[model samples]
Target: EESGSDSSQKQQSSQKSDSKGGSKGEGESENHEYISDAKKVMIEPIEAAQLDINHVVFLDPGKISITCPKDIGEHRSFIYDLETRQVVKLPDNTTVLKKLDNDDLFVMTKENTEYAILDGSSYTVKKAIMRPANVDNSLDISPDGKSIAYVTDEGLFVSDLDFQNPTRIVAAKREGKVFDMELPRFPKWFDANRIGYKVVGFKGVLYCGVVTRDGTVSKTYMEAQDATLYPLVNGDYLFRNDSGKGIGIIDANTGQKKFITESLLDKEGFAFDKNGKWVSYYMTNKEVTEENKWTGRFEVKGISSESKIMEFETEKPNAKPVENAVASPDGKFLLFTDMDMTGRRVLYKLEINAEQSQQSQKK
Candidate 1:
């Protein structure tokens, strides 16, 4: 483990440009035709009402769940189906926390501090499990819907769907130590038997690691001054490294790292397309921005080849920067929210005709 100051220095050094003095240019735009073929759809309008809609979670390509506040000061959850373009409100006052691979939903109602697993087909509570004491509100269900992992004041714990035979996978090692802290953030099931979590070290260095259900911690795969780990569909973990200077993917089994790109590493906006074959991130022209300072664009690239597939500029000058960009499950649509100058949050979807775009590139 490295000291907090040392880690901060290393992170800054990693972000500094190398001796060659790399050219500060937004490399040649690739697949320009792809951008022309894509279309933007307004899923939700910014001026619709006084409602604050957020927590958009895609259950699949066609279905999404979101949280909206009610007039009574309670939070209501609903699922929107793109196929029918209809939003169906959930029966309970709970908001969805996670949608399992089996389509089951893990939801929490803060009013009663209760957690339940809902059936995918019936939209009914399949089971109500025992709530952990001093819950950190970090919960994740396994893809197979058999196991659930969460965090508590004591430590990280995992149990079967029925909440039987619970096991404390990671002890609260920082408890009672100097600079003690609260529960970890985003304790998630990496696979059926393995989980990953973030914890604060002695010097406040945030460390992320994976552990087995039996309570064995794996070697720390990666660490940074600040990093949030998101498990990919293919079992790899994607995280911004070097204090948000770059994004990298780590092989869960081998601990090998492959950076997607070092350019625009300072931007905090990026997401993998639904199929995980493509990634879209926001970027600004280094040369142009050095002169103008208010210009930026979005870049889409192939994950394996690390090749740019398309690039497009936002609305410009008055363009609202995109935030929380996410791809639909099928990879055809990119969804994100942007707040206008008037402070209105608008949700937009970019539809990609990938097949047509590729054909155009070949021509």
Candidate 2:
């Protein structure tokens, strides 16, 4: 909870390149506020959590909902209010489909079989959304929250929030485009009128496709031999960054690649700020062997200018490496997921210096 210099586990170094990324001088941190301290959130006390937290959705700046995978102690989701330090179960024992920030409406699901739209403020069921019987991670609500898009055994369909008037958008029988329940890249609503999906073809090839409300796929992004496409919030994507080596943003609309950093090794923890201005990922120079595979240098860089904002290496002896990172909504703090020796995932919040964060917020 204390945010100050924790030099013991945080490494701030001089001008050098560890791998192919993060070229910063030793004095670089004097101008920028790097990581300070980290403390585990008090969520472990809740026994149902089973010492694991994942799939976090920000209900607002003050509240968040988290859910662990099915393999956890019990399949359930809980909402944690940061200000009050209270946890409550979500209605329908559902998983949040989208972040409910200020917006009063969002979709959540129960065991992937049923869907419901709820009012964020009251947490009351607003509409009965539909889900494909056999699908997981199959539904995405439109940006406007008026429509829901989902994938089924037959095809992809769009319907009103009430689960009625479903219009088939893509037919698997005719287009050979099917949504894979096993993959994390579920159906996504990229804009007000379109849903994005990825089609895995023969030999592990991928096609990043965007279908408009009228079901048109033109000039889709066909992937290179081994590249996996990750969708960006704006329908652009992490086209070249999937390999954990070259990190970048590819404009699927124009096919322009914006290289953020090259030679990063931690694909497990790649993230962009809410505005897509800053990027964070892990990098390493030494060979990843059994002994030191879980330690490396983490960096945050400006996307367009390719400038290094800050870098630090985390130290966790005999524990797992940081697997995920999220920038706070105000661009002032970073939230990370680390682990203790017992393999319990812990959430840590690190804040930048007040001056640096205040300036960022003004931007």
Candidate 3:
């Protein structure tokens, strides 16, 4: 079982946890944008429960990573062991970023200026990196977790595992960015060779841009409206619109756009199952007529293949939307969340695969 840590303790600890049809090239494809609201298909989840945290990520089958809210008085992030029901606290004011292969996590300080690697096997700060002041709070680790990338006033920088031997491969002037507040969040590596970042058109519209490691930038395809970039596959990308928090995708080459869920009240309600079989996301049920009640449902679909849509219930009639959805490692289960009248986060479970759904139905 993994255990909690104090500011003084140092060691390792435990626990860790796209679709195709993008364009192929350099010429812009006439600003083709596809917007389709998620088709509503509400099904009762296999199980439902609630949690009291700001947000959470499923770490593995038996564990979860959770960040507590300031009002909750915990003011820290930790790993929650489900079967054992134990909690291991991480450093205060630190956000657990990505879980690394060596049982470590890439962490960003709450200040958003510093980054570090925390040992996963124990309670210890393995390394710390204070980035330049202009560095954006959002970052991404390479798929292998052996490298890190962040943006600063000087454009994009890449470094070994934890900010070691840094080099700026692409240089951007202030005028090229979407905002001057230095708050452009979450730069992603499409693969090892290419990196994707958010940019702005002359009209202040958002565009998801891609650049190769050799300093070659691609013709922008994500130029439809103002949307932030999320990775879907190698060339196609997922995007959350700048307004209304609608979820969509843009072609890495042609810039074509498609909406999965038109809008999500919460930022993290959308997630994918293990093995890339299905995507689960939350969206407001605008069709709901009741006032002062919860008005959202989750939708699921296959990425490379098609599957029956999966959804959760709005049984409680509370006002808050479902906040997040986390998939199990085996791709059989989806753990999702919402809120209660007291403002606590509620968790629910659904079986997506046929075998799991059958067993859950039997039980």
Candidate 3 lands at a TM-score of 0.65
The lDDT values for all models are 0.60, 0.56, 0.54
- State how far residue 161 of model 2 sits from its true place (Å): 4.3
If ranked by lDDT, best first, what sequence of candidates would result?
Answer: 1, 2, 3
> Whole-model lDDT for model 3 versus the true structure?
0.54
Tens-digit lDDT string for candidate 2 (1-363): 112443322333322222213442321111111233434556633444464666666666666677655553345667777667787766535777666334654655555666776776676787776564554456777876777777666566778766578887666533434443212134677667767665544434355566786676534555422344555555566644444556777777676665566566655556665455666676644466556654445666666556556556545454344665666665565666665435666565654433222111100
lDDT of 3 by residue, 129-171 (tens): 7765666766677755677788766677788755667777656
The C-alpha TM-scores of every prediction are 0.70, 0.69, 0.65
Q: Write the per-residue lDDT of candidate 1 for residues 1-363, one digit (tens) a residue.
A: 224543344333221223113332221111112133232233332134444565577888878776666657486677877666666668647778678877788787664357788888778889786665666656777777777777776677787765567788777765575666634556777667677788755555466777877786565664433565667788777766534345667776777777776555344347776345777776544453434543355666676656555555544455444665778877887766555334544445655544322211111
TM-score of structure candidate 1: 0.70
Task: Judging by lDDT against the true structure, name the best candidate.
Answer: 1
Give the clashing residue pairs of candidate 1, or none: none
Note each model's CA RMSD in angstroms: 11.0, 9.1, 15.5
